[model samples]
Target: MYQPDVFAFPEEGQSGPSLLPPPGVLSLWRVDVARHCGQAARVAPGILDAGELDRAAHLVVDADRECYVASHVALRILLGARLGVAPGAVPLTREPCPSCGGPHGRPATGGGVHFSLSHTRGVALLAFADVPVGVDVELLPKTGVVSEIAGQLHPAESRELAELPEELRPAAFGRVWTRKEAYLKGEGIGLADGLAAEHVGTGPRPGPGPAGWTITDVRVPTGYAAAVAVRAAGQPAARDGDRRR
Candidate 1:
């Protein structure tokens, strides 16, 4: 069984088994880097010059931005390994969505692989598939203010949140939010299309249509909530989707 509880940091030059997907099906790994650019450079080569990495590290290494940058670095590394391409050759630049020009963007090899990146706390999680996909994580302590933002949730999610008692609200809120965000990210719709949480029991929701999605709960530590959304449409082929910059 794949065990998140058993996770150990990779030693220099060695990699760990993926926690997000079944063993051997996906290659997910984590690394703690001192700065954003070095992390990025480690995951995707040449995407940052030495100077750029140093500067980005200085700008984003703090607690607030570390998670997002770490997620980017994790994805860069995964794709580089799976595709047998140079990390820099994977196209890590941030670009506006072609459909909505929103901040939602992703790295692409133009080789047919869809992936998503997310981080909370110091750990970054990345998901890659043969179909469009997205992944998200919520660091629990930071998610407490979610009630104020609860109105932003899809109507169904709001109702569900209302049912949860005050104490359990935070976990429930994070679960739905991550689920919706992951689904939208898989669709390449970003938040512009708006996300909704439709609960069909407490497990993975398979898509309703040809272009719908498949969402899976990511088993992780107690202090966090996570989910992975993968497109259900067409044959699963490699395609990159939205990723945090």
Candidate 2:
């Protein structure tokens, strides 16, 4: 098994172990990056780049602003801990797109380590590994919203959802959405590739990844759905519908 612990961020002023996971293993960190007075000191200093600050400033909702700033600050702190650098000094950039060579692609760091981040409301998930990785955390949608979007997913996935009981389909759709987004984010194509482009099965557990990748559900707090996708390093595909850590 990879690192067994899915750690919460250290409380303010507390120190902890290196945040990097073992090679072929992923370290997933759960952070409560909400906006509040007590959390401000730790958060403000970690807002390293002007771009982030500007983006955060443009978020009109108080909660949206809070999630953007605090989660990004948390990302830098975790990356700094892993790399032995000051949070502000971490080399953060974007990789070129694999398909169009566009400047916007996967967010990246200069060193070999790979990571991905996703946040919903007050919480964020940070994933780290030696190989390319992507993760997503989402608030479960309402039953009606799930029904409306179900038709846009892969045909097989829609059929699977159609077979599920009405009340169950929302959670089921959340799983499928998280899985698909995780894989697309890892591939650096994102929604530009379209939702119907990939078939991540709609089931109690995740299905197999597209070639050269592995997808699995991430066990998160109730009322949310989460998943992670990792690029293969010539290793056998991860066992699906079982690996939760």
Candidate 3:
């Protein structure tokens, strides 16, 4: 599937987003949004666009607003490093929806690159690829959440999740949900396409993705789950600078 090595986001003044990926190499990066929240006062500021700044300002709660700022700042930093433009100048936009041709699709950039971003309260994940890609990170949900949502998945996936012990269902549900979301993000259809439409499994690993796409679970900190999806048609070439955290 060409999932590149996962990297801890580079700190201020440090090298870069996994040493700034070489041309055509798929790259994934993770950061502690909560941790970055503590530094938002200095790290945010001019890195974000006006829209992002306004969005962050509207998140009244301190943690929520800071997390929003931190994640977006980290996104701009990495995208800037990748596209060789200033962090504030990365030309970000959404694509046309694959399902309806609406202008509300996955996040994208003007430079010839494909990327995806996903973040929860404490964690943020970013993916860059030469091919269409989507990535997601989510905290483990409550068992009640699992019970409520598992049935909305594909029949086979619902059955797999149902067979699990209640204590284990949350992580399994996390896997299933992240994989499902990642796949959809890559397809530029989002959840409006219906969760039951695809059968990303609830097991430790993901099942086969839609034709022409690849999905897989990604390792993250305890209590969270992450995944990435990429078009399999034209996987990027491997590079020697690819790294791991």
Index of the highest-TM-score prediction: 3
TM-score of each: 0.68, 0.86, 0.87
Candidate 1: count the clashes.
8
Clashing pairs in 1: 112-238, 112-239, 113-238, 113-239, 113-240, 114-239, 114-240, 130-237
> Mind sharing the TM-score for model 3?
0.87
Per-candidate Cα lDDT values, in order, are 0.54, 0.75, 0.76
Candidate 1 C-alpha error for residue 190, in Å? 2.0
- Position 105, candidate 1: lDDT: 58
Instruction: Please give the lDDT score at residue 89 for candidate 3.
Output: 81
Compose the digit string of candidate 3's lDDT tens values, residues 1-245.
22334434445622245466676667887767655565544756667778988888898887777667777877787778777777878898887775666889878885578888888877778888888888988999999999898878889988998898899999989998999898778877778767887777888767776666778788888898889988875643222232110
Clashes of each: 8, 0, 0
- For model 1, how does the per-residue alpha-carbon lDDT over 101-191 read when each residue is reduced to its tens digit? 6755554456556667776665566777766667777766343586677666666566766777777777776676677666666656567
* Model 3 C-alpha lDDT versus the unseen true structure: 0.76
